[model samples]
Target: MADDDDLLGELLRFKLEAAGHDVTIVEDGQSALQAARSGKHDLMVLDSMMPVLSGPQVLRALTEEGSALPVVMLTARKGQDDVLDALSAGARDYLTKPFIPDELVARVNTILKNEGNRVASADH
Candidate 1:
């Protein structure tokens, strides 16, 4: 997950780890982009606002590179425009800040499950 807020980052990290996920927390969008491009993670929980590169910018970059990495956009921008922008940019899911931890985990798990299924089918 990429979030500058230390508390929120740690909180989500704890929750995700508890649910059997190997989580990596990055403080900025640049690191988030690097992490995504490295192909070390199965999915990404990205914050829309960050220093260096914003989440939408990262999405655009990855799309240009033909990356199929699944990205879950987590941001405080509750505006419809922001949501549409991120979704249109290719985010697998858009979640606003102050989200319910359990719900976020459930959503992440669902996305990962679906992605795994898609990959499995593609390999056949």
Candidate 2:
């Protein structure tokens, strides 16, 4: 997961960890990109307005590189256009800030479960 805001990042990490997830935290989109390139991750929870590169920028780069890694964008922007931009840029899910931690965890679980099902179906 990536977010420049330390408090939010920490809170997110804590919540995810509590939900039995192993998470790696990155402070900026540049580090996020590097981690994505070098590691195997089931999903990404990205913040929209990040330093070095915005969340959508990172998603675009990943898409351009043909990475199939699923992304969930977190943002304070609640505009319809903002959501559209993120979806177009390859975010699988989007959530506005000041959200419930349980909801975030639930979303992550659902995405992972769906992705697992897709992979299993593909193998069949």
Candidate 3:
């Protein structure tokens, strides 16, 4: 996860870890980009605005590089364009801020589960 808010970051980390995910929290978008490029994580939960790089910029870079890593946008931007832009730019999901923690966990789980199924089918 990449979020500038320390409290939210820790809260999300706690919640996600409780959901049985091994979570890594980064405070900036540049760190997020570097981590994503490392090919180590299965999914990323990105905030729309951050220091160094915005969520959309990172998403675009990864898309341009043909990276298949799934990204979920967790941001305070509730505008239609924000949602549309992120989805069109290749985000797996776009979730607005002040969101229910449980909902986020559920969405993450569903995405991961679906991705697992896709990979399994592709291997056949």
Q: What's the count of clashing pairs in each model shown? A: 0, 0, 0
Q: How far is candidate 3 from the true structure (C-alpha RMSD, Å)?
A: 0.6
lDDT of 2: 0.91
On TM-score, the leading prediction is 3
Candidate 1 Cα misplacement greater than 4 A, ranges: none
The prediction achieving the highest lDDT against the true structure is 3
* Alpha-carbon runs more than 4 Å astray in model 3: none
For candidate 2, write residues 2-117 as lDDT tens digits: 99999888998999999999999998999999888885788999998999998888999999999888899988989999999889878899999989988989999999999999
Encode model 1's per-residue lDDT on 37-76: one tens digit a residue.
9999999999888989998888899988988989999899
Question: Across residues 55-103, which tens digit of lDDT does each residue of candidate 3 receive?
Answer: 9999999999999999999999999999999999999999998999999
| Evaluation by lDDT, superior candidate among 1 and 3 | 3
Indicate whether candidate 2 or candidate 3 has the larger lDDT: 3
Q: Compared to the true structure, candidate 1 yields what TM-score?
A: 0.96
Model 2 steric clash pairs: none
lDDT of 3 at 64: 96
Candidate 2 Cα deviation (angstroms), residue 23: 0.4
